[model samples]
Target: MKAAQTQLNRYGAGLAVDGAFGDGTDSKIRSFQSSHGLDADGIIGPDTWRALVTGSSGGGGGDSGLLTHAAAAGKFSAAGVTWASSGNCSNRNSTSCTSFDGLRQASADGAVTLRGASGCALTITGGTETGHASGTYSHWNGYKLDFAITSCLSNYVTGTFAYSGTRGDGAALYTAPSGNVYANEGNHWDVTFLN
Candidate 1:
């Protein structure tokens, strides 16, 4: 069970790997099963275990080719990224703070790509903390991040990436070939980093 929890965390489920099959672990198991095309019955049976171990529905491959997991702010800083918050909070447990725990590695890599490509100073204003919309691939779930806007980033994202039209809130959208989505949210770019 501890291994299962660890594997789920590797897949960005964010469950505590304490070996306890609690509600959070159960929910993450069900979500992983559903996403991997197994039965979402919340049962850690053979099929689900296989999928969890291999990151695939069936057997054959070692991993699903999607590398993702939780990371800290220092990891981002080491990657040449910075963060800020309007409320000036830095605590991860605080809703008003900019948190990065459970932030998908792919998301951080995407930000690195953006910073390198744009040659701009990228400041992340939001992360896997609260205050964003709720969804399966939401900020709280580690799939999304919010980057503070700058003229250089604006020009690069708009000019370099392909425009995918505007979002529901009328924010201009851009998509990179790596399957990451960027929405212009006025003061920041709401980026959804996909694997």
Candidate 2:
């Protein structure tokens, strides 16, 4: 418990490094969870504990915003989730995996298409895949990305958006998608075009 307290302090909570996980520890945990948008159940779980350690250790991008301008460049260095900017090619690939733009480029002159005609069946933490919108697909251009993703082919990926209005190309909040991935190896990420 003392070691955990020390780690928590290092993460920026600065609570007493008592060896016991008493009220102080519980309080500290709840506070941290609340700030990080966790469940705040006061009982640390894998996700909560990981978030605590991540914030304290600054593993990726702790308490501070998950990937500041990084979202625009397709980066995910933060401990928690973050909504990325709007655009098809703005991000530079935050993860080591890959981006739709790169795949599209390799396709028929940089044009990526889904297997389904319109809506199939998909979900993410918060939204669902209804359809798709395509155009020039410039990087950082927000688009109204409707989803109908599934979890069979693959899950977990980037949702770089390319919107239509004059809305600024940036993230607003951390939203969960109902499904993780869409059809045709595409991931279901709630991408929006801000105006």
Candidate 3:
């Protein structure tokens, strides 16, 4: 059997990845399973693994947010953060195939705010989690911002983001006479970038 913690982390859920199923990890796991519609057995299995990989079921991808995982699920400006986008058009080329950005957190509460910059006007990939006031943000410019926010004290917080993208117009244009391309199929929502 796998150490409970490993399974949880693998699924994109965040919880410190300590490799030990401690009380904190267990509670987090249960919360994650509950959010993802898992069994809540505090054990990682095939079904749970799938859910984790898909990032469609879980509590902020497990612990942190979506910006931390890419090949699986999951940007920036200021403080070394900037948004960037490239590749085939999506969102009418307003969002792009990928975007990069970052998030800022309130020191007192850890509530995070984010923004990004990119080249693509359309978005080929993007997603957002309306945290019960805490979660992450993924922009199609090849960027993801994560945090646990109950409330953002400031009107506009500041932070940084990094990003990149593939070369193609995405699924819609796959047959549109493009040399070679693919959409950002990755789930893009696994861990909370709280840290």
TM-score between model 2 and native: 0.29
For all predictions, the C-alpha RMSD in Å is: 12.2, 15.5, 15.7
Q: What is candidate 1's lDDT per residue for 71-161, written digit by digit as tens?
A: 3453354345788876787655678888776665566557766766777888988987777889988987778889888899899888888
- Tens digit of lDDT per residue, candidate 2, span 27-111? 7776656555566688777776675455421344332332222221121111112222233223334322223332211111101
Clashes of 1: 0
Clashes of each: 0, 34, 61
Off by over 4 Å in 1: 1-71
Ranking by lDDT, best first? 1, 2, 3
Which segments of model 2 are wrong by more than 4 Å? 56-195
Candidate 3 Cα misplacement greater than 4 A, ranges? 1-14, 57-195
- Candidate-wise lDDT, in order: 0.74, 0.35, 0.32
**Which is the leading candidate under TM-score?**
1
